[model samples]
Target: MRKWLTGAVLGYFLYGLFVYWYIYMGGPDSIPEQFKGTSADPGTFMNSRELLLSGEYSRLRNFMYFITVPYEWFILLNVLLTGLSRKMEQWSDSIAKPDFLKTSIYLFWLSLIVTVCVLPVEWINYRISLSYQITTQSTTGWMKDQVIDFWVNFLLMALLVSVLFWLIRKYQKRWWLIAWTLSIPFSLFLMFIQPVVIDPLYNDFYPLENKELEEKILALADKADIPAEHVYEVNMSEKTNALNAYVTGIGSNSRIVLWDTTLNRLKEDEILFIMAHEMGHYVMKHIYVGIAGYLLLTLAGLYAIDKLSSAVIRNWGSILKIDSKKQIAALPLILILIGALTFASDPLTNTVSRYQEKSADMYAIQLTNNKEAAVSSFQELSKAGLSQVHPPFLIKLFRYSHPTILERILYLEEYHAEEQLKESQD
Candidate 1:
C-alpha cells in the first residue's frame, strides 16, 4: 500500500513536469516575418513590435490558462474527487437502498460536489474573460447557463451510468466490449443531434440574415460539393466577443454555423474566407475521420478503465467500501483513471486536429484564391480571440487544437500566391 501510494505521488509529479515542459519549454520566438502582423498585401510582413501583444495583455491571459487550468484539472480536482468518492461510498452503504438507486444517488451527490468545488475556478476563468471583454454574459446569465449545463450533464450521466452498470452486472466479464460497442452509436447519435437539439438549449440560432454573404457562402459550399442548405448564425454576442464559424452535424443536420460576432465584426471577404475554411472541413471529410478516431480512442480507453478499475477496486474495496463496478460509488475511481488517461492522450488528439485544421486552411485559400483575405482574417481572429502568436512548443503540442494563428499566417504566406496564380491560369 505504501509503495502504491508512493508510485501514485511520483506519477502525478512526473505528469506535472511533463505538462510544465509542454507549456513552458522549447519553442520558436515569434511568427516568421512575412506573416508577423497585419499587411496590406499577401506577402508583406508587419514590424515585430506590431505583431506581438503588449506584455500586460499577453502574460496575464497566458498565466490564467497555463497555470489555472492545469492546477484545477490535475491537482485540485484529482485530490478532491478521490476523497469525495470514498465518503460517497460510505454514505451509500449507510443509506440502505436498492443497488442501482443507491448508485444513482451517490452519482447525483458526487456531481453536485464536483460542480461546487470547480465553481470558483470557473468563476475566475469567466472573470478573466470578462476583463478582456471576451465574455459579455452577466453573472445572472452565466449562472443560468451553469444550471442548464449541470442538469443536462447530470441527466445524461445518470442514463449512461445506469445503462453501463446494467451491462456490467449482466455480462460480468465482457461488459467493457459491450459498452464500447454501444458507445459508437451513442456518440454518432449525439453528433447528429448536437447542432439542432443540444446547442439551441444555450443560445438562440437563426438562419443567417445577410443575404449577399449567405449566397457567397453557399456558393463556396457548392464549390466544395457540400449541401449547405442554409447558413445558420448563432447569437454568440450575447455571451462572447470571440469570432468563430464551423461546419457541424452529419447528413441532413449538417450545415455551416457562424457566430453572430463573426458576422458582425468581419468583412465580407473575410467572412467568405472563413466560410470556405469550414466548407473545406466538410469536403475533406474531417468530421467522419474525427469520429472514427474518437471511436478507437473510446474503445481503448474503456478497455484500460475496465482492466485498471477492476484491479483497483479489488485492492481497495474493503477500505473504500466499493463492492463492485456496478456500484455508483465506484464511479469516482473510474473517472479519475479516465481523466488521467485522457490527459495523457491529449497530444495525440491535438496533433490530429491541428493537421485537419491546417488542411482546412489550405483548402480555404485554394477555394477563395484570396491570400490577403485569409491572412487578414487570421489577424482579426488573433486580436479578437486573444490567441498567442507563437505559443511554446509544449503548449502547441498538448493544448492547441489548431495551428497557432501566427503559424497559420506564415504558412498561408508561403503558398497562397502560387495557388492563386495557378487557379488564374487554369
Candidate 2:
C-alpha cells in the first residue's frame, strides 16, 4: 500500500512538472497583437511589465489547478492506506452510541484530517495571490475565512453524510439511485438559500449603493422582462482586486450581484453589458438547465461511486482495512473515487459551461446593441484578473468555463462587422 502511494505521488510530481513546462512556461511571452487596441491603446490593456507578471501568475495558478487534484487524491489515499480512517472509525464507534452519531464523529475527524493536510496548499495559493497584488486580504483575514469555510463545510457534510449512510444501510444495492433522487431537491434548496444564507457568510451584500447605476441596471433588467427591484453589490474590494459580476439563486431568491471592484473599475456601459450577460442566463433559463444537468451528473457519479467502492472493497479491503462499502472507514476510498471521476469529467463539464457563457455573450450584445462595451468589458476583466487571453488547450479544456478574453473580443469584432455590413446593404 505504501509502495502504491509512493508511486502515485512520484507519478503526479512528474505530471505536474510536465504541465508546468508545456502549458505554463511554453505560452506566448506577451498578449497576442490582434487582441490589442480593440478597447484601448495598443499597450493599455496590459503593459510589458504587467504582461510578465500576469504570465508568471497565470502559470502558477494553472499549474496549481492541475496539481491540486492529485494532491487531494494523495491525501485521501494516504489516510486510507495508513489505517488512520479505520482508527478514526473505531474511536468514533467507541464514543458514540447510535450509528448516525458514530458516522458523524468519524466524518468530522476525517474532514479535519483532510482539511489540515490541504491547508498549506491553500495558504500558499493565497500568499501567491497577495504577492501578485490580486488580493489585499491579510493573512489573518484569510485564516479567519478558512475557519469559517471549514465549519460550513463540516456542517453541510454532516447532513449529507447522515443522509447518505442512512440510504446506504437501508437500501444497500439501490442506495445510489435513492441518493440521486434526493439530490435534486437538495441541490435546488442549496441554490435557493445560497444568495440569502450561504453568501452572506462570506461577504457583506447590500443593494447597489450607486442609485444612478442601480437605476440603469434595473432599467436594463426591466427591458429583459426581469422583475428586479434592485441590483446587489458585494464588498469584494476589501479582499481582491479582481472584478466580477454574476446572477445567482432561483425563483424569489434570485439576484444580480456585482463586486464593488467591478463597479469601481468598469464604465457604466461596460457594467450594463456585464449585467445584460448575467440577465441572459435568467432569460434563457440557464439556471434550470444547469440544475438538471448537475442532477444528471450526480446520478451518474453516485452510480459510479457505488460500483467503484464495491470493487475497491472487494479487491483491497484487507489491505485498506475496509471490510464493506457501507463501513464508515470506506469514506476515504469513496472520496478518492469521486475526486478521480470529477477530474475526468472536467473537460466535458467545462465545455458545456463555455457554450452557455458564449451564448450569454451573444444575448448580451444583441440585447444591448453595444459591441464596444462588450469588447471593452471583456478586456477590462482580463486586465483586472490577469487572465490569460489565450490559455493553453488543455487548460482551456479543463479549467476555463468562459471563452478566453481574446476569443470573446474577436467574436464581438466579427459580429459588429457583420452587423455593419448588413446595415450598409439594406
Off by over 4 Å in 1: 1-29, 32-87, 90-100, 315-323, 420-426
- The residue pairs found clashing in candidate 2 are none
lDDT string for model 1 (133-174, tens) is 778999999999999999999888888887888888899788
Please give the CA lDDT of all the candidate structures. 0.77, 0.87
Top lDDT prediction, candidate number: 2
RMSD each, Å = 3.8, 1.7
Evaluated at residue 420, the lDDT of candidate 1 is: 68
Best by TM-score: 2
What does candidate 2's lDDT look like per residue over 144-237, in tens digits?
8999999999889888988888899889999999999888889989999999999999899999999998998888988999899989999999
Report residue 356 deviation for candidate 2 (angstroms): 0.9
